[model samples]
Target chain A: MADTLNPPGQVPVTVLTGYLGAGKTTLLNRILSENHGRKYAVVINEFGELGVDNDLVVDTDEEVFEMNNGCICCTVRGDLIRIVNGLMKRRDKFDGIIIETTGLANPAPVAQTFFVDDTVKEKTRLDAIITVVDAKHLPQRLIDSAEAEEQIAFADVIVLNKVDLVSPDELAEVEAQIRRINKYAKIHHATKGNVSITELLDQGAFDLNRVLVHAPDFLTSDEHEHNDEIRSMSFEAEQPIDAERFNAWIGALLAEKGGDMLRTKGILSYEGDDRRFAFQAVHMMADGDFIGPWKDGEKRVSRIVFIGRNLNRPQLRRGFESCQVA
Target chain B: MSETADKVLQTRGKTRELDAFVVKASFDRSGSACAFALGDGEVAILRQGADDWQRIRAHEGAVLALATDAAPQGWISGGDDGRFYRIQPDGTVALIAPFGMRWVENVTSFTDGARTRLVACSAGKKLAVFNAQDEELKVFEHPSTVTGMVFDGKGKRVAASHYDGASVWLVASRSDTPRRLEWKGSHIGITMSPDGDNVVTSMQENSLHGWRLSDNQHMRMTGYPSKTQALSFTRSGKWLASSGADSVVLWPFFGGGPMGKPPTELAGGDGINCTYVACHPKDDLVAAGFADGLVVIADIASARILPVAGPGRGPISTLAWSPDGAHLALGSESGFAAMVDLSKK
Candidate 1:
């Protein structure tokens, strides 16, 4: 019976995902070898990939299992649940945990595990989902593998590695393709995975309060050709939303189409309320809260983003518009 | 209740600060000594009236699992350093098996007749069984990593629970196949009744799954708010006490099993979860340790609870009753170890 009011401190967990030959091993080695002054217990699919050695390295079998609750999209990494539990027993030995998934891993199950397992949720926080992409081959990967597209769609930070191998124009094209699939991820250009450790760790990217931080060019209007079936759609409404209607509409939408929705996020200004509402979801599992009251004179605009496959822009727009307070 | 618990700790309890997370504590069969496996890779042994515990560095890493050795005088421990060891009462350690880099997740031992003793330890997907002569008898493989292992009452069979099911194998049989009890989810821990008629597992989900060996009948126990990490059966094998909910949930195992009856809840409703439970060796009493560091012993006949220790520091990680049912040894994750002499009460 951990005291809910004053629970123990949670260790941050970072999940590293990438395609084959994307220089993930390079980044992992840097994290482990550099004098960052942080002790991280790394959980990798195999040992000996990194040239640098760590004191606490654990091997995991990417064992995924469906939940018994009948939710088709609520699959979780069973191995992670076990490993995290074991690691927490030795919590004093490490500062953080880093999990490196296999190239073919579905990031959804790994992400969903932090939400579904009670022990994991209480002991560790999902810091961020960092996906490494090959700048020279991302365009081809997007076309050839659905996993590649899904990885981009679920990332909070995209490491655009191997920028030196591709032409300037080709790099811009690859960046645009990544943006089309995921507009919220912060894109970092690096060669040989030489990104700053600060940018990748402790991002708090999954925190509801950090959701919907729109960049200057985040809402840029574009009518680009479709290169992949997966894409991102964003919506903004100036009028305050009826909370009840919006809840009903979003509930029904997620229930029917959550399998197609990889990730969703929003910050809303509800009718007759001064506080801001933050919402996020992975498939059908949704979480939300009133983060805080609006700043002194800030504009109370509501914004939402959905990264998924086969999105119906017009139908979603209509459903959103109908929730506005009339 | 809090005042009474404090008085009990002050009058009848002897406390020790081990300066490490206490993983598991058990008493030897003769009730002469108790051993505690610690996170700092050491095993501490305290005899019945010893003023201080003797510490032995048994492994190079945290001792993940510990059990009283089948030999009447020592303890067996498994460590994250991938080694299994036997610790003598006099602070001597012996390496029993070396698993290189894989963790020795669990260990259990049982004595058969007068001379034959069996020791079993699981490392990942393989379970290695050794005999009294320290000879590797057999290696059992499971479909997935074995989370829990236990021997039946007769020590002729052992059940290993893993993902999806629990497999019961005859300890001495040469056959590769075992009697499988199939379920759908991950089974994290397992226990068997003394009568050997039931095999129960604590699932990764907040529930318990049990199977009657007679027909492989499934008895699903649901509605636990958290994962049931601890489960124990009374001496008569009539009730199964578990930790998961706010209370000590005791499921009746005598009247046609706990298949359709409601479990009796005790010493709870305070918004605190019970983390570990140990039943008295010869009585219907059960000692339950809470997540808030409270220990309460409940009487089954009168439905009364006597608080044995007050809440503080950290959650209780292990609890065990001495063979004579007169002493209770408990430890918390914050290194608090206490031996309570309940015989005087």
Candidate 2:
């Protein structure tokens, strides 16, 4: 079969997010000016504008189409669909795109835009969400705004910028705090928002490997637990799940509780099949694909990660555990 | 002669997989060639070379929209690759312009004798108007991303549909402010009535909204089961046809307007939604493609339905009738394309 469902050639989009004054612009300037030969179309809001003195990079304003759904997420989604769809129409425009969100903006709406819109879903892939964190002030900022924690939870890569301002022990404590909020993200330390541009771009942060590595023991047990409302949980099984049942359960689960799910991802071992089923969901929108078969001597395990507020871990665990083949 | 033309009827001819999941199809002025916007970011030109249609693959990514140009007698296509291209009947492709990674969501062409203009919109909420020589004429900034665009009768003005409403701009004039027509929801697809009396937009809320140009009277055409993606006005401007449900909904544009009167349904039922609709250029006939990939032509006067093509690879995304009404071209989401001769022998 020629695979009727052929994935269209999609442009990769990387989102830059952090609270106000977290060195996001400094990092953005570095990424743009760094001798990385790749050309990028940077999408940035003008309110918290970067004082980018470099003539090397130019930032332009883009109005995200507003959706009248009475939901913040849907509103962001409408603009993204139009903007992304519009950007995809031109040829040789850029190798990739970078979107810088407002300081107070929630990354969920921006990330969910990729998954929900049919046009955006077809033409652009969400590469990664890089959240720049102010190491010295994160503790106070976390208490000041929920968006601070939301950014931490949704980020695939957390740039702990301004590390020079914090003591070594304080840096370690901040790292530990971020881990407690989001155990899946890869953390990097930076002083002036200066980090490896290569490492940040094309990171495939949402790929199967990262999801598998972070949540392997998630289903087995919980350690380094946090009492915060926003947390991560895992569900795993050694045996394969009934594909139909699993899909039905997940579909209903997302339909009912998707708003509370900041992020959800999983790799499953299907019943009677060697092909591994890897899937991920940003809120309600979910995408799954069949990866390669299980390697020799590799454990046949399925694992899932959910990061969000008021996550009913016990209910989700029980529901996922019930999906195993009888 | 009428009977002969009617007997010639609608018949499927020459199905090709030159590309995949066609989003739009267009036929040039003479009907000698047809162009298809493939979902895989490629434009396939089927030229009438010698005996049969020869396929030519035209772009690098999924072609989002396609427009037919009459003067140069070719087709223009915009793709996800952020490039606009003009493909001639001879299969020669020219890069019209590039939008630097912005998806050219829509491309529309207007021609007045030797004067030609190509207007395209990109992701940054900007509209770039170009002359025939591909020179930038004017760039219009919008409050939101544009959803759809349509040209007026004289090809002098263009209306762009967006989040809140639509904007009507006189492309031929500079310093003329585009007449902004406001409504409340996100408008997806837009069309101007043939007589230029009103503008109607397909809303995201599974309904249709319209505004009379003369008085800006807001007209609501609601009660649809799905979002109306395609809209067409009859040649006489008596009816406006839309695709949203199993049947083609024809709103009467006669009398005072489509407000007080009820809409007439045609060529539908069987649980298959009409995915696209195209009115014949010179007749009261309309061709509608169903979600099942079936294409049928219906005469509004006689209420007769003739199956043009069907059981296709996927849902029909686009249907275009040549300017002279000599041929009808249809393309589906699964890369299936066919051109049917509609003229009398």
Candidate 3:
């Protein structure tokens, strides 16, 4: 089961993140203590100073540092590249890696490292970005800092921790708040980071089927829209899109609005094609491939979800509709 | 300068009409021929003739790995199709091993006197060794999936680099225990010195780690701006040239070893980082490819660099010196290739 889930040759890397006091350490400790029959190399902040129970705990002292002013993308990534690579040299040491980013840290640069670097890309696959939100304070934290909102937007799975501290209605409100920024991320309710090991690992959130399965109506929900500048816009088309036209439109759109577009994903049904085209974009980079043929009884449809700022829903809708096979 | 350029023979442009992403390049034993694996699972083998290369549909998917065949005239390649094959200089291909549906990560073959052994690593954490007859010899399982593999100089042993370190296995007999060279970290590339006295690995952490075979003494070479993806040792094993920064750093492996000796930095500046390097099979000259898609040949004693390939293709992905040291074959990520003949100079 350990090697079956992840493709052979490449190791799965899980980015574990949470705002301050959201029980990230507790979740990390739980992942470490669980008898999951797997080894994890945990990269925590100031690991050398803190005594963690894990045998393979690596202390990374903010390896990502700013090299220039106003450029949020300067973290050397070479540090994590070094650690992940160093961990790779001892191939027998661990099965997977868990990188726990700091509370205030934005996960964008970290995620970009996996995409931008070739050496890191060959040996490791980013399994998922798991964000553990402080259920009690996330409401205000989202408004207080952009870092918190960015983390929620980039997450593949959101663990709303400390549910006991908030009422059920409050919990629903927090869930609604998270949905406004990222409707694609799988959300789980937890009181003390008590979540199943299966929910965290081997979650092919990056896979098109698994991504679209959990959030079937993500792009259609209007009530969950957030007031903050960040918003999630989901779109669906009943008719299949002309693959070439759709590609050109998206390419031009990302080129013009990529700076504001945080993350975009879609499972598109194309004309003259039985297989579904699964696409995802991070900033300016986008990649898509055919997943599989639509089931015999399944309805053919195209759905897309974008999380970003100042999104002109009407304009984007018109642009996507124009790509339909004409 | 133009007169000097006229002395070196250069063949440029795409080997085939179709665009491809060149994954790797290799030279046969005599250095008279070369092979380049494409992203679409096809291979283009070029002989000594002028632009004499033909494309072969080598696999069903992208061909990711290629190694010089144990024989003197062919190559061994593995693909994402989960199959490994042996391609002769004449375009003849044979399946060496099949691994159900797993991607074949790497393949390396070595010739020991009369016997030739071909080893292939699959995505399923298994290494299958085959004899010259192409019969399966033995399959060894690793704690993790193997990243890279190489055969020692004598062809008696093969080392497979994986999670913790590398495992050195004896190909002649199955009873011998694989000596585990443990240096904790992800080791992507592995190479054994020509003399078989030292084995070094290019770590995921922008550095290199080596071991002296006799006493298992560890050698650490660190502090690079980027991850070192390419490594090459001189014919005499006196120097180890690696790519990590704008230039190639050649570490002195003689006398007191690379321990405290200051490395000789060659052909670096601006923002261009070396992506691959290859030492002449018989000379002190080394060929280095940069991230800017340029290939330069550097002389050890003279410290002079000659531009063999120009910029504008893509990052140079692979470089290899022909056996006679007369030609240097270079490939780029953009599926372009060029061969520079040094004999004319």
TM-score for each predicted model, relative to the true structure: 0.93, 0.69, 0.58
lDDT of 1 by residue, B135-190 (tens): 89989999888899999988899999988889999988989788989999889999
What's the true lDDT of residue B235 in model 2?
A: 86
| Candidate 1 chain A lowest-lDDT run of ten | A1-10
Question: For candidate 2 chain B, which ten residues in a row score worst on lDDT?
Answer: B1-10
DockQ of 2: 0.14
| lDDT (C-alpha) at residue A32 in model 2 | 84
Candidate 1 structure quality by residue, lDDT tens digits, A6-41? 123888888999988888889888778778898998
DockQ of 3: 0.03
Task: State how far residue A314 of model 2 sits from its true place (Å).
Answer: 14
CAPRI quality level assigned to candidate 2 from its DockQ score: incorrect
Full-model lDDT, candidate 2? 0.76
For each candidate, the alpha-carbon lDDT, in order, equals 0.85, 0.76, 0.76
Ranking by lDDT: 1, 3, 2
Q: Rounded to one decimal, what is candidate 1's iRMSD?
A: 1.5
* Highest DockQ against the true fold, candidate: 1
> How well does candidate 3 match the true structure in TM-score terms?
0.58
Q: Candidate 3 lDDT, tens digit per residue, B1-345?
A: 333442343343223433566777888776768888877778888788656678899987577788888777889988766788999878889888787655576888777636555655544467788877888886777766676777788877778776667888887675857889988666767888999888889875567889898988999898778878888899989899999888889999988979988889999876798889999888888999888777788999889988776676678888877778877777877677766666753
Superior candidate under TM-score, 1 versus 3: 1
